[model samples]
Target: MEDDKHSLGLRVIHWLMAIFIIGMLCSGLYMKSLPLSNEIKFNIYAIHKACGITILGLIIVRIFFRVFTYVPPLPANFSRFVINISKAVHFGLYSLMVLMPLSGYVMSSASGKQIKYFFHIPLLINQNKDLANTANELHSMLAYFIVLFIILHMLGALKHTFIGKQNIFKRMI
Candidate 1:
């Protein structure tokens, strides 16, 4: 198979997104482990919210570039099952990327917290206790799924890089 290349813009955004996501995940786990307190929880939530919004923006730009550019194709020797799994994984990643933040926004809005976007503006949604609770639960649950997906993703990438000896990892870099 030909060595697939990533566009400079895509590569930059991809790495930035990866760093942002990893940071957010760490912050989130830390926040979850902390005791509920106004000062500490509020600060962590603010940072988490900011990161989520930034990720949303970056994801939008990534999608636009993905639609316009030609990403490298999978290796020809790759089996159809492997190809199908890759497609499924990609779909899940994108879907979670979009949904996780939206769920968090809904949860924050429902709890009557000021949804600050990078300290730029405060967003408000209708205050409904039930809705907020539901969103919070969904967000929490999806977070676990996202964490699992990420682990699987990293394992797969490592397999391609070391075991499979494929260019999949290099193409992204």
Candidate 2:
């Protein structure tokens, strides 16, 4: 059981990233649907940007931990195809984890909005209308892909936990 589990640091970071990512996705959608003149909408935007930057920092730490830690292997019973799919899903998730926040930062920075880490420290970045638009478009498009990948990841974990009786979820726990 011990051998099958991820390191404590990894598990904690994984869950933290998951929570932030899910929150960001939902808040982002909600903010977009809100009226431009809404005061609460701007507040949500500030919080969203702050959380996005936090996610970016967490992701960097997550990557560093992932590199230096021992990652538990998947169940031995999983077939080659299943393993391949799992790898692909993880790759996609990791990529999006980095890209999503980065795109958001670029969008905010280019739009001439000063980004504050947790609503305090300022991050210096130049504004460019064209770049802002481009980043916004990319960030918007990436949202769908991130959602899809997250669903796939959850489904795969569910399959292993219930159908396969592998109890793979224990690893993260």
Q: Residue 159 in model 1: shift from native, Å?
A: 1.2
Question: What C-alpha lDDT values do all the predictions have?
Answer: 0.83, 0.89
lDDT of 2 by residue, 1-173 (tens): 68999899989999998999899999999999999988999999989988988888888988888899989888888899999999999999999989998899888888888776635644456878999999999999999999999999999999899998998899999
Candidate 2 wrongly placed segments (more than 4 Å):
118-125
Q: Which candidate gets the maximum lDDT versus the true structure?
A: 2
Root mean square deviation (Cα) for candidate 2: 1.5
lDDT of 1: 0.83
For candidate 1, the TM-score is 0.91
